[model samples]
Target: MGKALIAGVMRWQNTLDLTMSPGNVVAKPLEHVIAANDANKFIAYNNIPPDIPKIKTKSNSKANKNKC
Candidate 1:
């Protein structure tokens, strides 16, 4: 019975160690991708490119246009 109690305590300690370990939590790679996208959006909103032409859509052209 003493050996069984020690074994149970060791198992509980191992479980606690695993849960408390700092390396157990990992960030997903997509988090970096989303951060990069946010940074790009911030830069784009702050600085508008002058070379790109502005598109103006006519209300009546929807019925005749084949190319989008």
Candidate 2:
């Protein structure tokens, strides 16, 4: 499975194994990739809450660029 650098942003992942024979470097099927994602979700974001709290980006400071 592809390492979760961030999160699974794309549907496809390069799990192509190069340790085996040169001819065996083919990518796995989409179903396997999807399953890997399912397993990865828990390990990756397990510490995070189900509904991540939104950060308050609004600021009343004069330095705010969007104040206009």
Specify the highest-lDDT model's number: 2
Could you give candidate 2's per-residue lDDT for residues 1-68 as a string of tens digits?
45323365655555544434334434333334335353544323443445567444434233546536
For residue 59, what is the lDDT in candidate 2? 47
| Candidate 1 accuracy as lDDT | 0.38
Question: Which pairs of residues collide in model 2?
Answer: none
Q: lDDT value for candidate 2?
A: 0.43
Worst 10 residues of 2 by lDDT: 25-34
10 residues in a row with least lDDT, candidate 1? 12-21
TM-score of each: 0.15, 0.17
Prediction 2 TM-score vs. true: 0.17
> Candidate 1 residues 12-39, lDDT tens each?
2212332233454332423443354534
